[model samples]
Target: MTIEQEKFSGGVAVITGAGAGIGSGIARRAGEVGMTVVVTDISAERAEQVAEEIRGAGGKADAMTVDVSKPAELDRLANEVFEKYGSVRLLVNNAGIETIGYAWEIPVERWEATLNINIHGVIHGVRAFVPHMIKAGQEAWVANLASIGSFGIMPVQTAYMVTKHAVQSFSECLYLEMELAKLPIHVSSIIPGQVKTSIFDADAGKDEPTSTARHRQIMHDIMKAGGMDLAAASQVILEQVAQNKFWVSTQPEMTEALIEGRIAFLRDQAPPSLHESARQLLEA
Candidate 1:
């Protein structure tokens, strides 16, 4: 039972991290598709601003502040949405943070923060919203945002990669469980290749050793130069969501080879180093 794009009309979409970047792009697109969009973010002001933009464009939208890392806050968000809207047709767990540094060198606090937001955030959303969705007996979809780094590796980005890999695994398990239960709910793991976003701003500003700082800067530059536009990427993602696709890759051609290479390496075959090309591009 695949959901068509028209099914989104008059539905409710709750998007976390909708204040900026790819999350904001998805919120705006949801509004355009005639869904009542809930723009949620840790930053109240940014959430409000995105909501206002949607409203100004003659779309129904509301803003809510939510720190997805907090389970209680996610519960509150679910309650508010259910009380006001009665149903949520789309739940996007898109809130995430990035930390840079080797696994051993990165602070424990950073590791905890990344795991809480990137992995636990998705879990909290599922725990809070899935029951309501089932009770409502509505066809719904949950899209958990992962990254290419989930399958590929990069130096000095252990924390971010670890969380994304977890998201990929969790999303797959959720999909399988839902399928076995014969539920109307669908799950998708969104694997996005560098979309133009401010995800690296903190890394860029970090007070790191010169070598680490330079590496971070290189990554920022690469993303800025080669990343796809956020709106375009979000459109691709939403289309896949509507079709009930399990694996949503925004840049498949670029990522497929890397994923294949990883598999080959795991089989004890010679495979191209995942980050070698990225490093070469940066040097060039």
Candidate 2:
């Protein structure tokens, strides 16, 4: 059955990276339907703040500090959720980081950190949560955040792009595995182009973007020109979850680009034709 047709009554969801951005939006949407939400993030206070907002709005929610890269943290978060909510039917692996640099300029440390959070974060989240979720034998769902970067041969994203592509393929494989196991679990990957979020602050620091740099300004412009808002994307995600769609995508305008990109990869031809703004984006 479709995610919506299956209904979310009595289900529980635990979302990582819920302090803000797409993760928070997803939590809010799930709460709107009266589901129990465990809002988790590396930032403990922010996660709690979001949880408080949910409760203030008459939704059941709990906040926990969870670093997706840490298995112990994820395990503790899941334990707390099950202890309180009794069951968990959803895991949103949304904690991610992007380390962008020219292939030569990229630091191994930074690249690994990105993978620790982006790829391994998803890995740890699933490893720590899914076994328990399955052992509980409940109908559940897993949503891993990928990106359109997975499709683009866009330059400079390097490790970030590689990790996202891995996420996309990993999610698909998990979905099929669940089906083969005859388990009542659903898996999906989201490949959004650029949602209105604070992701540009990836290196938000005393140095990198320096916190006061033009990071936000650039991200804002990107979202305005090349991205969609979080709310709009969240609606599609909820709809997708309800439908158990394997791929949740947006910006119909980019549909053709993604299609052609995939076709090129399969035929061992050139990467898909670039978007009109590809040059400008690549230079960015």
Candidate 3:
């Protein structure tokens, strides 16, 4: 058996945003690896559809409606999961939304939603669940979704990019906290590079500035053309998680390149500039 199966088989995994995109892919992969997967999403129908797919395939799964933007909701979810399963072996804070617009042009509601879901969601997910995992005193894993955007700068995607940067920093600090406490809980920052997901769907950006439609479509096209397959990326992410890696990346080369660019920018105190591709996309 592979390390992933050896480590995660017969465990319970709780994943947020498992109705679609990377979250759903990881949920399916978890079920395939012999875990009982709890698939949570804001949309009850989407969550149940994924859960049914897993169950139909002879894997174990359950669906629940969860809005990760609320801390109280996450607390309730943690309590319910622990009560039902006795222990949770994996927790993935993977629910996030992408908002496309010039920072000033974005609506107040969109800005708040982006910040609450992308940043606070991950924070509260950790806060609400860690205590339970600690009390259980069993080895567990927590993976937070940090994007390649964490290491770079973007203009129109300011809201989403900032949240990713926060998640990356949060994960770094969380890893150290686990080490200091000598806990069996492992923390991983999942940096995905262009994974094929519905993050940039037109309907998802309805709340953003109307002028952002072109930019949003450009990004959606780019993702469709070049992003890695969702299932493949999920496999890579979970494998690294099973190995207890602190930095789990679907595309290591992309992560390395972004990190290198970030290092140079910091070392030289360079003014932020858009890449050629980004310029083309934004200007299109």
Candidate 4:
């Protein structure tokens, strides 16, 4: 048997934003590996659909509606999961929205949503669940979704970039905390370079500035053309998580390049400059 099966089989996995995209892929993979999967999303219908797919495949799964933007909801979710499952083997804080536009141009509500969902969501997920994990005294895994945007600066994508940076830092500190406490929990920062998803779809960007339609379309096309396969990326991520690695990246080369650029920018104290492709996309 594979390492993932050895570590995770017959355990319970709670994943946020499992209705679609990478979250859905990971939930499916968890089920495939013989875990009982709890698939959660803001949309009840979508969450149930994904859970049903897993059940149909002869895997165990359940669906729940969870809005990660609300800390209370996360608390309730943790309470319920622990009460029902006895213990959680894995928890993935993966619900996030992409906001595209100039920082000043984005609406207050959208900015709050982005920050609350992307940053606070991950924070509260840990806050609500770690105590249970500690009390259970079982080896558990927590994976927070970071991105390539975590390392670099972006003009129009400032809101999204800010949250990613925060998440990366949070994950780093969380890993250290686990080590300091000598807990049986493993923390992983999942840095995905580009995997196929609907983050930039027109409907997903309805809260952004109307003028950003072109930029959103451009990014959507780019993802469609060059993004990694969702299932393949999920498999890589889980394999690394089972190994208890802190840095779980879908594309290590891209992560390395971004980190290098970030280092140079910091070392030289360079002003932020837009890449030519970003310039073209914004100008188009």
RMSD in order of candidates: 2.5, 3.2, 0.8, 0.9
Ranking by TM-score: 3, 4, 1, 2
Q: List the residue pairs that clash in candidate 3.
A: none
> Could you tell me the lDDT of residue 147 within candidate 2?
86
TM-score of 3: 0.98
Clashes of each: 0, 3, 0, 0
lDDT of 2: 0.77
lDDT of 3 at 49: 99
Model 3 alpha-carbon drift over 4 Å, by segment: none
Pairing residues by index, what is the TM-score of model 4?
Answer: 0.98
Higher-lDDT candidate of 1 and 4: 4
lDDT of 1 by residue, 66-105 (tens): 9999999999999999999999999999999877776777
lDDT of 1: 0.87
Candidate 4 lDDT over residue span 120-184, tens digit each:
99999999999999999999999999999999887778899999999999999999999999999
Task: Pull out the clashing pairs in model 2.
Answer: 3-242, 3-243, 4-242
For every model shown, what is its TM-score relative to the native structure? 0.93, 0.88, 0.98, 0.98
| Candidate 4 error regions (>4 Å) | none
> How accurate locally is residue 104 in candidate 3, as Cα lDDT from 0 to 100?
95
Q: Looking at model 4, which ten-residue stretch has the lowest summed lDDT?
A: 210-219
Residue 163 in model 2: lDDT: 90
| Candidate 3 lDDT over residue span 1-284, tens digit each | 98889999999999999999999999999999999999999999999999999999999999999999999999999999999998999999999999999989999999999999999999999999999999999999999999999999888889999999999999999999999999999999999999999999999998888887888898899899999999999999999999999889999999999999999999999989878877876776
Query: Over 4 Å off in model 2, which ranges?
Result: 1-6, 202-220, 271-276, 281-284
lDDT, residue 61, model 2 = 88
